[model samples]
Target: METRKKILITIGDPAGIGPEVALKAFLQFHDKAIVFVGDADVLSEAAALLKLNLAIRAVDSVSEAIFDKGILNIIDVGALRGLSWQKCVPTAIGGRASAQFIRCAVEIILNGGAEALVTAPISKEALMLGGVYYLGHTEMLAELSGATDYAMMLTGGRLRVILATIHTAIRNVPDMITLGRILGVIRHANTAAYMLGIIAPRIAVAGLNPHAGEAGMFGREEIEEIAPAIEAAALEGISVTGPHPPDTIFHKAYNGEVDIVVCMYHDQGLIPLKMIAFDRGVNMTIGLPFIRTSPDHGTAYDIAWQGRASATSMAEAIKMASTLRLPTWR
Candidate 1:
């Protein structure tokens, strides 16, 4: 009797490694309690291609799912049978199916059937081509769950980084780095820390400009916005620090000086995590009403369906999701 709420998984783009990795990871942690929100045919196809003979079954709910030694339960989200999808290539049909899977999973979790969500990798280009117009999973979940203030966080090994701005162009980043947004992300970072059961979390904020703007030499964003946000969060009794040089803040986090690093942009944080823990990193969305986690890797179109895609990240995402419950996004 595993009373812990089941983890809902959405196999990402049908044309990518999402299905293969998801099915592979599901086998690794099937006892953790999970229900796949995806196309059963796609899952079977991936299993066949990977030479896995695990029994895959479709159900309407967790209660209807028949979990056994060689069987995996899935709640099929799309009727994608007979569709010709190319492996390793983004297609509108695949994107549509992936989006449907995500939406169905969100609906199930929000309805109290599950406690957390683990999604496979998806391509933004394919998502748009399929007429599902959110930038990524973070955006899609935020809008679907009606969460306005949310931040994307990626954690692996000892490193956890939260993004202040995500899925935007470099030139547009400066404008998006307002004091309000930074403060929100910092608060969200704090929320993320609590979700992971960390108390009095040490918060490290990375500077936007080089050398932390060198005190307004390279850029004034640190002086005008980032620093102020940190100060404000601190005044509210949060153990917050920096606008530290981006080059060095991650090093400090990795060494355990800080519990989490509040990165100003996407690459500033991900580059370090992926460089080191790409195989097992977990991407989490903070400030959402329900727990949401995803593998930090993307649809590896280059190696899709070749059975070379690693399931380590996917397994890690499911394990993390199963452990963390929904927390207040304050």
Candidate 2:
């Protein structure tokens, strides 16, 4: 029997449903070794509120964890005290705690202590409030892990969409979408598909303009930028077809016609993905040195403590993180 790979899970915000969903997922996959990196007190409180008698064993190190069924091993960061699950709030302490837990989980993956990482939803505002100056998890992970060119790929069962530009202003997107950027995203999409065990991944690159520029009648971005980039990627031996109409490409990809769709902009890709699999989507970061994925949704502050938050996305993320097997680079 092979040993189960340990996955480092970070509970993003104690005040949010991160702890709850993580606890629930762990309970469901009790056979796998999951190291929860967050406030142990917060997890215990959330478990109590949900009427779950889960044993959160605090371990000093990941190796010390006894991989057993029906038990959760935690690498407690000691972020909160007297954690109240019912009265959860977005406090400075909570924000700082979330940042610290993320840092710890990333470190564990980098140092080879964990096989993969699944981060819960974090608040961009709270993260900034905690004095960490980063837009979101993708940026922070890139900087921390030294990943220069990384793309965000959202996966929901059948549909997979990769973004060219993420978390940038709508007006600034045009300037940022260059030939290099488009090719980089396509390359990452191919690599991500391969990691998911797909050989010779077929990628459909979405055009920036309507109707794929309608032969330069609608817009010149596809004619001048996107089409050329796709041509360049094809010459490199990647199975890529390109400059497809953004509107219809996602529909085809969702139906399994294409392995992945490389979208030109953020909303151009995410709008359809969120519509189809908002609750079950997993946001995976490609071109990173380490494997990193998160649930598609955000902190969901309105339903943080109501026990109304669904764990399906988080559960899918955990399962994906566990299944991803990276190759040994020479």
Candidate 3:
């Protein structure tokens, strides 16, 4: 009985701060429409624990959602219906619940029952323990949506970065940084920049070694792989540069000198972004079959259910995805 297209919000891990922050975030959007695709009971528990003033309604499908300001319409996946949630830690039940919620959300999105997706955070360890094979959201979403060349792009204020590699061991990062890999990520970055309304964006590629490999003094990745990727991208009409000092490219991006930076690995990009927008950054998956965004941070198990988790990032994720269109991830 829903009258409008609703953006679907998936509560990540019931045991973490996902459910609590989800309730807090959606409450800020009185004018925009959204629906929760997770446990109705868990949402109720979060609402009661947080002293949130709102009406929670359970529905069987996306069509049953109602777009009212004070009422939250939820599709109860019931992964943890009668069980108690062990807050602030990883549990098999919590992991299974998280997987189910995300799987259900994918179905709704593919079926056109929703407009876009705003996901809460989920734990990789919990997911693997629960028999969900993927390491993180990007990998899981890529597989489920058939997204082949997808990349994780994080954005905050004027800073934006896409990772050449994510969710992998640091020891294995160097071996993975091939010319093809860097080029693919740069193309994804170009697509992402245009998606964000940046026409002719200055894309920067961060070097794998210090001082951008010091012109082969520190490493050859810059002289051989990184620079080649940048040149190839530029030849294809992308305003790209780099092999810049890994230490300074982020600062340049922060000051708006570059629109998007293709980082060599995970922490290289996230460390800088989180420092700038810890409570407001948005994690977006570029080249997905559908538009998907999430809070830049993960499920805060340390402060889970304390009602201390900030909802600004979650709200910002919803706001960001709500305005985006389906990307051509070719």
Candidate 4:
């Protein structure tokens, strides 16, 4: 029999519901071997709170892990000292632990000890309070892995969105939607589709302005920047389409008219995809040397430790990671 792939699962912020969802996903997908990279004590407490029957074994590395039933192999990062989970307030120890867990997980992936990484939701504010100066997992991972260009792709069952600019203010999106950036996003989306086993993926480009700038009446970005980018992609033999209006492009893509939609801004893509499949959408980082995915949601501090967290997105993330192979890193 073939051996199961080893995936590194990081339980983000102990003060949040990372541990709970991690356990829940593991229980649902018991056949795959997962090495939980976080504090064992926190996972233990979460398992108890959820009334799950499982065992936690501390392993030094992923190779030493034994794929067994009902046992969760973990690389213990140690528990948060003097951290209270009664409320979702951020503490120094919790923030430090979250950053440490991310660092350790990246190291494990770099060393070939893990095949893929599935990260739980993490709090950006908590990480900053904990003295880390990175934007989020996608940026930190890109810097750590030395990836030059990358885009955030959110995936549900049917609707898929690749963002040209993420984590930028809406007001700044107009200026940011340059021809070079649009071309970069198209190339990344093409690469991502190939990774998912699509030979010639159909890509639709969304406009920065309403109604695709109404033929330069509302804005000139569609004519000057977006249309040229799409033309350049087409010349490369890619199946590219549109400077379509944001309103109809996502609907057409969701209905199977296109394989992927390249949105010019953050909410332009996310609002539709999340509305369609928020509970199970997976956030995939494209143009990276390695395969990295995370849940579509954030650290639900308000419902932390209340057993109200959902594991659907985490499960989908893990499944996507396992299905796709990473590009070779030079």
Candidate 5:
């Protein structure tokens, strides 16, 4: 039997599907000591909507919580008693609640109360309206944890993408894609593979333009910046290769020629990752002090309380967190 680890989960946006999917995931997986940090009322209301008889026990502290099958232990951080599900939509209150839940979870991890954290989706617009300036989980987590060199890694099935630049404007990506940034991402990607038990992992770096700038005809970002980063990573014994064409590198990844693909921009990597692992992709932050993972998708406000949301990604996030916490067998 695998040793049980304490896993902390944050209900991202109370108005979104975070509560619903969180409830469903815990109902399925009962091995680890999972603590759901959010508004208890939101969780109960979601359970009621699903017509499922789930036991939601409130705990004053992380240590007081019981981790057993058939019970969803919660540490209520927000007072969502009077808030209706209808008002849960991207309002300031909902955004504040979501931010509160996230901060509470981070505190739990920082204080040595939890081994890992699994966050649900949060709305960016809601976060702004609630007076939180962070764009999303990655940026907020990096700031709260005081991590200077961190990268966003997305994993699903056999495909893994590590972004060189995330949450930036397309027009701004080229300027941000400096030699140091690409080299930093490569280092982070190496660390991530090590955590996943993949020593000597084959790393692939994608190009910034068609045919990798056609040897500097289309663009020089690849020839000038990307190629140098790959060379630097190879010198550090990373088994790195690329400046491969963005169009065909993914195909190589799918066929097992690559273990992780390093991309220059956001859509360059995610467009293919979501296409392959739409339902079960897991977003992980590399180079943090503690292990962190979340469902790759966002808050589906359109189907928040309709009982139509799929919990596959949530369950996978929980599973990935648990696995990452375990001592690597290899």
Candidate 6:
């Protein structure tokens, strides 16, 4: 029998749409070995709000989880105990509980209980309110795993983008887009391609400036910083190309001309990706010790408990975490 890979999922902020989407995903993917790590009450309330006809089973350990359909198995990290059902807001208590859920998921992966992690969206503001200071899921996971060379890759609708600089001020992006950073992101993109079953990945690098610095007319970051990085990567035997214009690089990725595109900043990559496939996008954290994927969207607080959140992205993230092969890790 082929042993199913055990995957852990953390329902991000209790007050956000994480719980709802997660439950919906479980309903669709009931046969997979999935362990939910979060507050049981929050999940139960979410289930009630969504009118989902399923049982939320709170297991003491991962081994006790029931992968059978109609049962949503959770490992209860104990958060948001007494809050009103479907009325929970972004409070410090909710934030703390969200952080605990992620921590618990990490512990499970390290303890050989799970092979991968698929986290739902967590609120940065809520995390700060709870006194847990980390930029986002990628940074938090990197710190927890002591990984120094990590990259964030977003995949959806025939497009895969790896961000060179993540969660930083726009004004500071030019300075942060160094040769080392671009090189690292290119390498990560190549690794991601390999995991996606692309043996020799054709990488497309997006320029930092308009028209690729207009051949040094608009900006020199591409001429001075990005070009050298591409040269270095090519010399290292990695198939890479461009400093292509930011506006059109994504079109190439969409048309399947390249396996992945190395982007300069967060919005530069995400705008095209979200525009292409907002609902089914999967946020993958590369260079980690274990596989970690999440929904490309954040905690949608407005339509959280109204049963309006879509589970497409969450389901795709879970599927990627379970199926993607990481040959680099071997």
Candidate closest to the true structure, highest lDDT: 1
Worst 10-residue lDDT window, candidate 3: 321-330
- lDDT scores in order: 0.89, 0.84, 0.87, 0.85, 0.87, 0.88
Which pairs of residues collide in model 1? none
- Candidate 1 local lDDT, 1-330, one digit each (tens): 658568888989988999999988888874677888999988888999989988888898987876566788899876487787777899898888889898898998888888889999999999888888998999999999999989999998889999999999999998888899999999888888889989889999999989999989999999999999999999988999998999988888889999999998899999999888979899999888888999988999999989989999999988888777556534
- lDDT of the structure predicted as candidate 5: 0.87
Where does candidate 6 stray beyond 4 Å? 82-88, 328-330
**Where in model 5 is the C-alpha error above 4 Å?**
1-3, 79-88, 325-330
Superposition error at 311 for model 1 (Å): 0.6
Clashing pairs in 6: none
Tens digit of lDDT per residue, candidate 5, span 1-330? 324678989988888889888888878787779999998888888899998787999997778887777888899985566765454478777778888888888888889888899999999998898899987999998888788888999998779999999998999988888899999999888888888888679999999989989988999998789999889988988888889999999999999889999999999999999999999999999877788999999889988888889999999999988887332431
Query: How far is each candidate from the true structure, as Cα RMSD in Å?
Result: 1.4, 1.9, 1.7, 1.8, 2.4, 1.7
lDDT at residue 271 of model 3 (Cα atoms): 92
Worst-scoring 10-residue span by lDDT in model 4: 78-87
Q: Please report the TM-score between candidate 4 and the true structure.
A: 0.95
Q: In model 6, state the lDDT of residue 11.
A: 91
Tell me the tens digit of each residue's lDDT in model 6 across 1-330: 327999999999888899899988877776688889998877887888888788889998888877888888899876666654333466676678888899888988888888899999888888888899999899999988778999999999988999999999999999998999999899899889877788778999999999999999999999999999999999999999999999888888888898899999999999988998999999999998889999999888888888988999999999999898765554
Model 3 alpha-carbon miss at residue 77, Å: 0.8
Model 3: how far residue 51 lies from native, Å: 2.1
Q: Provide the TM-score for each candidate, comma-separated.
A: 0.96, 0.95, 0.95, 0.95, 0.95, 0.95
Global fold similarity of model 2 (TM-score): 0.95
Better of 4 and 6 by lDDT: 6
Question: Mind giving the per-residue lDDT tens digits that candidate 3 earns over 171-209?
Answer: 999888888999899988888876777777888899999
- In terms of lDDT, the poorest run of 10 residues in model 5 is 321-330
Candidate 1 minimal-lDDT segment of 10 residues: 321-330
